[model samples]
Target: MDSRLDDARGAGRRRIPVALDGLEQWLRIPSISGDPAHRGDVARAAEWIAARLAKTTGAVRIVRSAHNPVVLARVSATRPAVARLLVYGHLDVKPPGPGWTSKPFEPVRRGGLLIARGASDDKGQFMAHVAAVEAWASIGGPPLDVSFVVDGAEEIGSPGLKAVLDRHRGLLGADAATVLISDTKMAGPGRPTLTVSQRGMLGVKVVVSTGREGVHAGRYGGAVIDPTQVLAAAILRAARVVRRLTGAGRPPGPTDADVRNGAAGRAVHRDRLAERSTTCGALTVTSFESGSTAGAIPTTAKATLDVRIPPQLNVADAYRAIAAALRGNDHPRVDLQLNCMASASGVLLRQPPTVRQNVDRACRLAFGRPAASISSGGSIPAVDLLFRIFGRPPILLGFGPPDDGAHGPDERIHLGDWANCVETSICLMGFLSGSVTAASTQHPDSSFSDTLFPHGSRGTAALL
Candidate 1:
């Protein structure tokens, strides 16, 4: 077994070029899940993954969803009693916006980086795991029992993934899971960070109507109530509630020991990320439409409010607070229409000692450094559902850096980091095979055993 592990490591190093070439081929397809016009391309990306895994995998199946399809594949380890790991990644890429040295879909190697729409966000990062699994299969098989879920819709809020996870919860179960996500920025190359928590989101559109129609400013402006004025006042009142819900100022997050002892110690400092830990929820007016002409007082006004809530806050309570705030002081003067567009709960992960030890060891083997723990201000909605299902913290390993530019123009990934990501995944699989123990052995404080709420409150469940 030791000899086979050694061979797998060597084989993985040898297949770098081939693996990169395959990634380029996949990148050539514009699988933009957000754009309905590119739905066919999304399916093509799923088919590509299925075809790639058909030969070495135990089974490859495409789970059909109302939206884009999800690819599921399994690979059995050579030996039994090894831990089963569910690996998660997305197959869809964000729509490329304006600005580029070349076309977004055209994969190009630019000196030291790969520039493409999905290169840094996911395709490049997740492919590293695939390459590692293939290398393992080349020598013997994966060191651990592996299951892969490469979903198709991530950019457009992942309704398809939500539906699939809801229906097939049993099939997705495993001893542990690692989500190979590059959506967050890490320290840099060779320094990997594991994100432990993320902020949740709640968005609502507020519409206000006063008089029947617009009043001419010169004649009737003073006599009629302006809906725009009402909206401005409501927003100011709601600001207090938003503050109460989010914690007014930055809420405390990672400690000095958590960051300095982890992978991000050298790259990130507490002061650098202090603003992201704000306890106060945000209230942004994304869109405002009211008056068409300056000479008239508009009767109707509309605004889109976007809020980012901390992981510790309750989504339902936040929603209620915002609604009450909107109805404050001027409850009868203006007609209010509050529409909730979307809401998802946040995550606060607790890692067991064994998982943390193995992750650090594996990272050192792959990149000559230990992994870091981080708290993300942004949220991954799917994570809430995943946590509810697994009841364990997902191993969040990221390869993308701050400059990766995911979902923005000129997306890219460092070639060196990409290689290290693949190697890290390989080491992770090998380490977990023999080291993983039953969850019962974990220290109560280290594991995710403590409930987030006292009663039957849908803390994480609200995410689904």
Candidate 2:
């Protein structure tokens, strides 16, 4: 093994303490972007990122948005950048709802796992990239022009991302450059996985009104239409509409490869993939309210519907179909209203050959094996928006394992897995250094085949 490779591995291992400490500090901030009470914490988290990136980046600034701030950093190479790579991730996290072995904000390491609110959801995963860059600096500087776009409002649907992305599109990448993201989950512990697709989401509420006030059931039992019954009818109609629009066939069954490569592949047999894929469009009535008593004909009733649209269907079209369905049976007896709360489109990533080859190499160095391609049932609104603006597909590489309990209590990521993530990121820098043209004039779809194996094209290990 090359001495520098040994040095790099040693350098990476030495930074583990710092990575853990950094993640703990970040988790302590309680930067819950969804809660107004934690607004300041969110801002503080952005400042923390700026402060860390300031050491290596020439320009580090927090871009203000309507909701939360965005941290943007730029690192210029000694020689003109052969290519630019945008590292995308979020610092914000979901609120610690309930259930915990310890305080969600207090980071803890049990066995080989680091536990906390944002431990695995994103903070730990994204910071792995930050630490990777730090490790590179310890051994030597990076080989490409790299920029970081760590935002603060990912948990709340990234409502402010579209404007931020559009405003800074040029700064992000003028033509098109590869974007790296680490907010998804790996197949399983010690196994690196790349997510290639995410499902879209649409939330709606159905309100039915029959009269100004509830009527006595005995006096108007058959005289008046029950609002609860009307709401039920509306929900039934919505289901029919979805069926018509999305069709009766099960979502294209997950390919045999999908089942084999998934993180739970060992536990999830091929026959189970279809059952799992059915969850892609699972629709649920999250909430329903009508009358206080069974003896009264309710005056009004409301139902909130949660809909998950598969990648094959258009999110907007599905939402429209839902609206049309609600309006289909407008009658004089009852008034119905369909309120669309939110909708985010799904994404399908196309891994260019250059990215796939280097990422495979990086996985081998990071996990002692090649990576498995997987798909996510969740949605990240910013990803689809970023693709629309940059025209380059973002590489979705994450360190969180399937059992990390993201968005739930005792959220955690394996310390060993995180270490692998750090090593993988470091290897990617070398692999992608000469992979892109230094000049930005190259065509958006173009990628050079030359790989800059700084030390050599070999994977090395110092310590796990």
Candidate 3:
């Protein structure tokens, strides 16, 4: 172990309390971006972040989009020779669902866990970076220039963040290395992780309408076409199209090798060959409406589909396939309307040697174990967007533990893990400072193979 790493870890342990305290305060605000009622609380959270950043050696600015405000802070290096690093995370959290043992907005500490909305999803992870910056400043500043871009609309798909990035391109510019995001999970409890890729997302509300007016089943049994039947046929066709698009009945993507070998595979029983090739779609019909009453043969029908596509798949092609499937049906009165369409963008992080080395070293030094490199199935538009705008591969090294229930009921952060994450953040800053220099001077294309687990592991941890 390096002496500098040892000293950094020691410093991190001493600053755990500071990180936890900040997390507690941050979780108290219900910065739920989806709900308009929480707009004030969201603004307050941004202000709180701005104030905290102001206390450090940086120029903090509160830039507002059409919706929420983005807190941008810069910690300039003492000497201009140092490189610039951009650190971004979301300040907003998903809306709290029901069935909470404690209040969602009011954080509660029970045993060694801090339970609250946004505790692990983002607020806690984001705060870790803030605490790291503060710690570095206290120790006479970091070796490189650091900038923070904390947004409030991340939970809502970063609707207004692209404009924000475009507007502040100059202020947010850097030496074109890698941006760091602490908004994902570590591979396992003790295993640190660096997320290298994320799957794209396409959400479409497929509405199938058949009739214009509600009529009694007895009166319109043969006369009117049932919208429900038409909708069901359309849904089935859509499912078939999705199955074809995902290459179902075949081996999973290359990334699924680890998942297939892990506990996930054991539970599902890999020996069951039929299930091995099955590619289950996460298509969810969130809402359905047809007919006015239970018994009456109603007039209209509608259903929404939420589709998750892999990085290898194209969202537009998938959409066209689904549309073509629906077109095959000859229901004269039925119509399909696409409510929303979002294309996903992804970047491969395997080629960047510096990013991988820094992430692996930082996580191992901080947690006393090897860190895993994994790809996320969920989408983070900001990651891809940042890569496009800055031409830097973003590394996601988060501290959130498994089953933190982010975006769900009783979302919480393990107190101990939260503290460890703060340490990890500090270690990452030092590691990245070194990595940037090494990467800048070394080969542009270098790939490292990751072997955290054997291939074919199908478990929640592996899949997620």
Candidate 4:
């Protein structure tokens, strides 16, 4: 073990509370990217983090994008380094819907968990890494050359991440970076997990509208058309398509014990992922709005659906299929429209055994156990883009507890798990420093991803 590792770990442990404080402060911003009303709040959150990071990082630049600004920073190596690394995470959060015991923006500590909208999802998880970085800074600097990109529009599908990457192409070259992401969830509470695969997603908004304004329900009960009823029919049609699309995907998943410790739900059958068959659509109706008056029929009713896309299925093909189903049997009185909110290809990350070994060693040291690589159902739209850019899939670390209620009410993070996460990240930095060789510990047949991802590591991009 390198002396620096112990020194860095000690430094990190001593400042663990600072990390918690950071999470608390940032959670108050209400940086909901999905809601246009919170646009400025999102940007404010980015600036707040960037300013704090500037103290230890070099050239913390805020790059403007079509949607939200990106915060970029570099941390120079204090000594000789073996790898050039990039960290990615998001700062934006999903809208805080109903059902909260406390205020969403106000951070509340309940028992061992920290309650806030982005707590377990990314904010709490990524702050661990931020704390680790600050620790290294306290002891001079990190052993590996590192840079981070904090995305401000990830919740809304990172509409401008590609352009931001393209603009900073040389700084974040595909040949240079090994990515790391902390936006995923643990297999279960207190179980350290590494996500090796992610599903693709296509989000569409369904709107049923009448040309005229709302009318009295009694007057239009039989004469006029109700968009709400039409919207319901459309949703019903979508549900049927989902049933047929996923009919061939009832295959059982692997049992948990070895590789899938505490993993929930059956896994997606490869056949389903490869062909048009889908394991599940996750056709979540995120938002629904219609009439407000009790006695009136609204002019329009709209709702959004988030459908999962198999890695094998292209976004356009899935889009066309769903669009056709929604319009195949149109309602004459009401017009329907589709707003494509998100579209991204899913990718199966094949990280080298060496990379897994490095992270596993850290997990064991920090969490009392090694990690298992699992496929995740949730979609992080930027993962595929980063894979293409880096030529290798980044190592996705899950620090949040399972059932953290992300994107829903009462979102929270376990403080104990959070401490472990900070320690694990600190250990990873030490391992990646090229000072500690895990050659003996690496599993046999370990090889780099036919090509390691060329994209940058997931930074506060997932947290911000």
Residues forming the 10-long window of minimal summed lDDT in candidate 3: 443-452
- The ten-residue window of minimal lDDT in model 2 covers 445-454
Output the number of the lDDT-best candidate: 4
Estimate the Cα RMSD of every predicted model relative to the unseen true structure: 10.4, 7.8, 7.2, 8.1
Tens-place lDDT per residue, model 1, 1-464, is 43455566667777888889999998988998878899899999999988998878748788987788888887888777347777778889877878666788998766566788898778888898899899989987886778787878766556667677666645554545544444565654446788777777877899998867677888976678878888989888887777655433333345444344433225654453444343446677878999887798898999988788877788888888888888775447678989987777877766788878888876766666788776766666667777777777777777875456677766777676677677677777877777422222222231110121112211112212
lDDT of 2 by residue, 100-192 (tens): 778999887665567889988888999988887787677565666778888898876777777776677656553456788888877655677
Task: Summarize candidate 4's per-residue lDDT along 18-63 as a digit string, tens digits.
Answer: 7788889999998988788988998899998898888897568888
CA lDDT of every candidate: 0.72, 0.73, 0.66, 0.74
Model 3 accuracy (lDDT, Cα): 0.66
| Error in Å for residue 398 of model 2 | 2.5
What count of clashes does model 1 give? 9
Clashing pairs in 2: 81-438, 82-437, 82-438
lDDT of 3 by residue, 1-464 (tens): 12243344455556666667777887888898879998999999999888888988557888987888998888865445245678989999887878677899998766456778988788888888888777767756765678889988887678878888777766765646458888876665545567656665666766666656677888768778887778778888877766554422333222344445433235543453322222333355667777668667766677767665555566677777777776666866567666664555544555377666666665554455656766565677788888787776777776776556677767766665565566666667776666322222121121010111113222123312
Ranking by lDDT: 4, 2, 1, 3
Which regions in candidate 2 have their CA more than 4 angstroms from the true location?
1-7, 170-174, 243-280, 292-296, 435-464
The better-scoring model by TM-score among 1 and 4 is: 4
